[model samples]
Target chain A: MIDQLIEAIIQKKSPIVVGLDPRFNQIPQAIKEKCLAEYGETLEAVAAAIKIFNRGIIDAVADEVPAVKPQVAFYEQYGLPGMAAYLDACQYAASKGLVVIADVKRGDIGSTSKAYAKAHLGQVQVGNKNYQGFPADFATINPYLGDDCMKEFEAEIVQEDKGIFILVKTSNPTSGQLQDLVMADGKHLYEKTAEIVAGWNDKICGKFGYSPVGAVVGATYPEELSALRAQMPKAMLLVPGYGAQGGGAKDVINAFDTKGLGAIVNNSRGIIFAYEKIGGDYQEAARKAVIAMKQDINDTLSSVGKQYW
Target chain B: MIDQLIEAIIQKKSPIVVGLDPRFNQIPQAIKEKCLAEYGETLEAVAAAIKIFNRGIIDAVADEVPAVKPQVAFYEQYGLPGMAAYLDACQYAASKGLVVIADVKRGDIGSTSKAYAKAHLGQVQVGNKNYQGFPADFATINPYLGDDCMKEFEAEIVQEDKGIFILVKTSNPTSGQLQDLVMADGKHLYEKTAEIVAGWNDKICGKFGYSPVGAVVGATYPEELSALRAQMPKAMLLVPGYGAQGGGAKDVINAFDTKGLGAIVNNSRGIIFAYEKIGGDYQEAARKAVIAMKQDINDTLSSVGKQYW
Candidate 1:
């Protein structure tokens, strides 16, 4: 899965992943009004609007970016209708020849984690047949539950050739409240988690020396980001906090290796709702945002003397 | 909500909560075959069977136990149909006058956490009206992302008079991998988490002096359970790892206050699937199992000189 993602990055000459974190307010007013007129300003109406808006964004940016990450929370806020929209978004992204990364930071005990793995990445068994719940090539996971919790994903990732990015250092301001605590071993909690990721990746590396297991290192913390990149050399970094979260291109560029292919920066509001700031058709604005982000990241990579390895 | 839960516990004279962690394979052969025949062995069939099984358990034990903790993973494994079953089971249990605690263990950043909280305990607004997703009195939360992650839940919990049990010391074997680490302040990670939980609960305590915010302390760790009980005196403890997870009556008693209150022990497989060990109808076996568990826990509490506070 990591190899395939890297190949897509190399082919597109872009390491940007458009985050589809669509909120009710972020959807174009015209679309919202149309859906509400049809469905009577209900959860159903909001969800329908989200699905259509997401399809437009995916269609406009699929050829420019390698993947689209649908933050599950936005859709999940509306309930079953919202989740239905989330599933449709994933399917449509996949249909557009783009990787779908479900940003569902789910974690639990071993048995429960297995259920979540099946729900997001793997297949769920019903009678003699298997069904994909929310089909995604990669899903984000939380690692607070320890190794046993992740064993479920390890088994499925190996079986299905899927991938997971474990949360190491999140982009949120208060993430350091726990993640940055100094451990007894003199490593920050995030560094210890990074080491754990490195160890897990040792068993699942692909021919390109990248692993299906990855780590989420925030773009907001450049010093920690550089250190984590060195610590987990084979782990692909899903760098969030870019653009809208106040992380600049220079800060995120350090997350990559000399090859500039190790990190994929995620920009949600900055790209998906760019029309709100730039004033244009939302889909076209999203496309333009993606192109600008790609150029900015590429320029940073080149200035740092990095190339595709 | 916590006061109501405690009063119910005192009235029922049982601090045990039945854990509805039903697996598809655990469904009775008769029930499974019937559902499969009717629904053609699809996800809908499995989910329908699960709802019926959960309703039976809830009906059989509602008088004996004060609450039901439905581990969401079991229902989630079957996909949308499973989630629909989960919501039905919760509603059915609530209708039976039992407190429903949805054991979701969900955590994320502030904005994302709000969606999860609304999805479980509170209600989500569409346009004109509000809707509850998987309505429950309380939902379990993971506090790995720190206070900001829980702030969203805290606000909603206060407004809705709902409750939450934050994961402090989980029952799983490898939980210590991150949870038990010693922090720079010389406090173990769980202890730090307990302090944080205590601080959060101060503003939410009810007239009975118990807070709606609670801690999940594994019954398996008796010493830690005792220490945590002392640490967060005002917080209710949801003690898992009882029975099937290897925590016996004596081990779990430490989680209770001198009043034999402030803690609710959860037993899933041991009670729900008791028919496997003792031959009889599944629901009857479950009822008998619940009665036996109640007797055992009461005997233990009496031996320790505890009474209703």
Candidate 2:
């Protein structure tokens, strides 16, 4: 899955992954009304509308990006029906030949963590049958519980050729409150996390000089992004906090390696809700938005003499 | 919800919440065969079998415990059918007057965090209707993302009288990797988190003098538990790692106040899979296990002269 994502990035000439993080306000009124009329104003109706909204954006950008990350929280907000929509979006995006990153930042202890790993990236067995639940090629994980908690996920996903982006430095305003804490050895908490990710990558280097084990380096912090990029050279970064969250192309470009292929910047609301700002068909606007983002990122990569494609 | 949970704790004379974390190997052979015969050994069969298994345990221990913590990862491993079992267990447990604490350690940033808060502890609005997702009285949250990520959950759940338990000092063997890190200001990371939880409690103090905001302080580290209990006096403690994970009754007792009303201990495998250790019907073994746990904890509380009931 990691090699495939890297290949898609080179072929598309864009290190970009669209984030399918739909909220009620982001969905077009027309789409909502259409689904509401069909299913009424219930969780079922709202979830149906979200699925429609996700499919439109996915269809619009499938040809231009490497992957699409569906934040589970958005779909989970609507309950079972909402989760049904989440599963549908993941399947539809993968069917479009794009890698699906289930952005479920799940982590826990041993046996419990294995359950999460099996649900998202591996297989669960019942008698002679194996079931794939929300089969995203990769998933995001929170590493707060330490290496023991992560070992299960590594055995389940990375060992199976799938991947995971462990949360190192998140993009939120107050993330520094915990992630920036200094350890006994003088490295910041996130730096320690990056070091662990880098060491893990050494165990599973891929054909592209990278590893399926990745690190989530928030693009909002350019200094940290640059420092982390140097710290974990082989890690494919899943960069978030771009566009709507105040991370710009200039800020995220620091995450790219000398080869310009080490990171995938994700823009959720900036692309999915582009229709509101662009005043055109949502799908076309989404497509145009992806192209514009691609151009913006490519311009940076080219300026830095790192544009491989 | 904080006051309600306390009241239930006193009425039941037990500050114990049974952990409904089931695995495939834990289910009785008879139950598995019956469900597999009916549903063909598919995910459906395993999930149905789990639902039945959960209901039996819930019925057995409902009179002895204040709540039941169903770790979502177990049900999630089976996919949608497993999730259906999870929801069924939560609903059935709640119907029996037990506070259903959904042990989904979920956390993210800003709007994403709000979506999670609304899904587990609050309601989602769709046009003129509001629908409850999981409807757990409380949910566990990961605080590694820091205060901004936690505020949304506080506003959504605390304001509505529901509650959340923020991870502070986890009981895992390697939890100290990040949690015990010394900050520049000299406080440990978990201690810093405890201070924040305590401050949040000041804003939403319930009738019982505790806030709806709570902390997850693992029982395995009795010294840390004692220190954190003092640091967050107005906050309730959801102490995991009690029986199965090497935390004994003596270790968890420190999480309680002088009145023995500030904490609830959880024992998953020690109770749910008790049949494996004792030769009896699974439900009977589970009931006996709960009774013994309640007795063990009560004795410890009584010896300390902190028995509120």
Using lDDT as the measure, the top candidate is 2
Across A180-261, the per-residue lDDT of candidate 2 in tens digits comes to 8887668898997887798888888789988888999898899999999999999999999999999998999889998788
Error of 2 at B170 (Å): 0.9
The 10-residue segment with the lowest total lDDT in model 1 chain B: B73-82
Chain B TM-score per candidate, please: 0.98, 0.98
User: Given candidate 2, what's the lDDT at residue A63?
Assistant: 91
**TM-score of model 1 vs. true structure:** 0.97
| TM-score for chain A as predicted in candidate 2 | 0.98
Checking candidate 2 for backbone clashes, the offending pairs are none
Tell me the tens digit of each residue's lDDT in model 1 across A71-163.
887776787788889889999999999998989888887878898888888887767888887889998888877887778898679989899
User: Judged by lDDT against the true structure, how good is candidate 2?
Assistant: 0.89
User: Model 1's CAPRI class?
Assistant: medium
TM-score of chain B of 2: 0.98
Tens digit per residue, CA lDDT, model 1, B1-309 = 898899899899989899999888888999999999999958889888998899999989999999999998787667778878888989999999999999988888777788788888888776787887788999998877888788998766888889999999988888888888887777888898898899987777887778999999998889999999999999999999988889999999889888778899999999999999997999999999999998888898899898573
Q: How accurately is candidate 1 docked according to DockQ?
A: 0.65
